[model samples]
Target: MTLDPNTLLAILAMAAATVLTRVSGLVLIHFVTIGANQKRALEAIPPAVLMAVIAPTALVTGPAETLAALATALAAMRLPLLAAVATGVLVVAVGRAVIRV
Candidate 1:
């Protein structure tokens, strides 16, 4: 199957945009000096973004997802991030199997 010219152009445009975004962030960081508070806020961004993405799905989805998100939060209190995420995945799988939802 031949790739349509528009599809190829769109793909190339997206790739360029992604690279430009990442490179711009790096360049900005290189020129900027961050203080302690700013650094702390920056460090918090990943978890905030993760929760922002997960919270809506957990709330909007069925019981299994909600239960799994709860489990993940509880696990996160004691475990590392990776383990907490794994706990969520495991809980969600089991919840879905048992609840059939």
Candidate 2:
């Protein structure tokens, strides 16, 4: 199947829309005044957003994937953030290799 010019344009437009939605808050923050209550809410936003992203993955993951994610999250909570991410990636990679063998 061939991708026509119109299809390519449509795909680009959809990608742009998705990116704009994701980054709109950062863009808007530069122009907006954040009050005390808003600031508190903003502080919670990262973990809330993370939970929203992670919860679905955790729920949908197979037993091995869930275990790997849990190990990564626990390590991240106790150690440096980057280390946690690395540990999680390692766990998932190792798990996948083991499953394949």
Candidate 3:
């Protein structure tokens, strides 16, 4: 299949924007003096963003996603972030397979 030129240009533009945003964040961080509380708040942003994205899906979607999200939350209480996320993915996969969602 042939790639559309407009699609390719859009993809490239998106990639460039993502890179620029990240680079700017890194550069700005080096110049800025962040206090302990600020740093902690900044660190919380990723997980907050992740939950903001997933929570809607879990709530609106069927039982499988909700179960998986619950499992992930429980796992996150005990496990590291990455491990907890993995547990969530595994739960979702198995839930879908078992429940046939």
Best by lDDT: 1
Considering lDDT, where higher is better, how would the candidates rank from best to worst? 1, 3, 2
Model 2 regions lying over 4 Å from their true place? 1-41, 99-101
C-alpha lDDT of residue 66 in model 1: 98
Report lDDT per candidate.
0.95, 0.85, 0.94
TM-score of each: 0.75, 0.53, 0.65
Off by over 4 Å in 3: 1-16, 81-101
Residue 14 miss distance in model 1 (angstroms): 1.2
Ranking by TM-score: 1, 3, 2
What tens digits encode model 1's per-residue C-alpha lDDT throughout 1-101? 99899999999999999999999999899889899999999999998998899899899999999999999999998999899999999999999999974
Clashing pairs in model 3, backbone N/Cα/C closer than 3 A: none
Q: Looking at candidate 2, what is the lDDT of residue 51?
A: 78
Backbone clashes, each candidate: 0, 0, 0
Query: What would the TM-score be for candidate 2 when compared with the true structure?
Result: 0.53
